[model samples]
Target: MVEPAHPKRRRAASWILAVVLAVFVTMGAVGCSPSLGSPPCMPPEYRVNPSSAKPGEAVTVSAPDATCNPRYGSNAQIRIVFTDAMGVEVLNTTAPMTDKGGFAFTTEVPTPTAVGEVAVYAAPEGVDWCDDTGTNNRAGSGEDELEMASCAKPMKPLTITK
Candidate 1:
């Protein structure tokens, strides 16, 4: 006659099976799971309302209704660079991120040292959520790496009228 299985052996075998099943279930869930209603990743969008400002005038830079990839989520930071006609940096500031993943900043142009145009550039710094190349290259792929919402164009020429 065959001997019955020992109680201790049965219990231990059951526990091991349970642990293995749990691990398999977790892996399956992670592998085949779909994203549940997540926002699309997009490059940070920015715009300076006028795109041009006179010396001593206050200009508003806006990052409106923007979305970042779920990978980055809401951990992105925006920076604005204001440069003069001679490519001299005038103002560099970090704008505050909004609840909707947007930002806005207001800065006054400094008195002109000389009469010429000033250029402004808005870009996103830190992690980039808009990257979709799947290479996970957040540094960007050249000039296209960062989003250029609006350029100063010719930037407004400053005139020192006495």
Candidate 2:
């Protein structure tokens, strides 16, 4: 006949199994912790001081509310486009993010001798959370085009007279 396990051995084996299970549970909890999720990602917030500027004037474009999704860190690029009333692009500048997780650009309205309006546009280089895709991806990534609402607005008309 087969001998049954001793009571002391059985108790020790049960304790070992319990400890192993506890360790596994603890590890799983840690692996699935909130901290393990993507960092708090934040979309760029474009703000232009004065919002309207005359020719020969300078405007400040700042990203004050800019922040990286805490889980993803700050990894993004910025591009600024300046266009004239004729729908002709005059200036295009790309500024990379600094270690501070923010960026800014200063542009001067050109004093055109022609009468027309000027517009400035700020767009995130890649996907933007504010975009319809709801994820920060690069532009043309099958994602909706990301643009700054304020920047997309047409600028005040400037009358050029001899």
Best by the lDDT measure = 1
TM-score on alpha carbons, each prediction: 0.50, 0.47
Q: Ten-residue segment with the worst summed lDDT in candidate 1?
A: 153-162
Clashes of each: 2, 13
Evaluated at residue 150, the lDDT of candidate 2 is 33
lDDT of 1: 0.56
What are the lDDT scores of the predictions, listed in order? Answer: 0.56, 0.55
Question: Once model 1 is optimally superposed onto the true structure by TM-score, how far is the C-alpha of residue 19 displaced, in angstroms?
Answer: 35
Candidate 2: TM-score? Answer: 0.47
Error of 1 at 41 (Å): 2.2
lDDT of 1 by residue, 45-143 (tens): 566656555677777777675444323235555667776766677777877665344778887777752346555666556544444444442442354
Per-residue lDDT of candidate 2, residues 7-45 (tens digit): 999999999999999986875555323443433244455
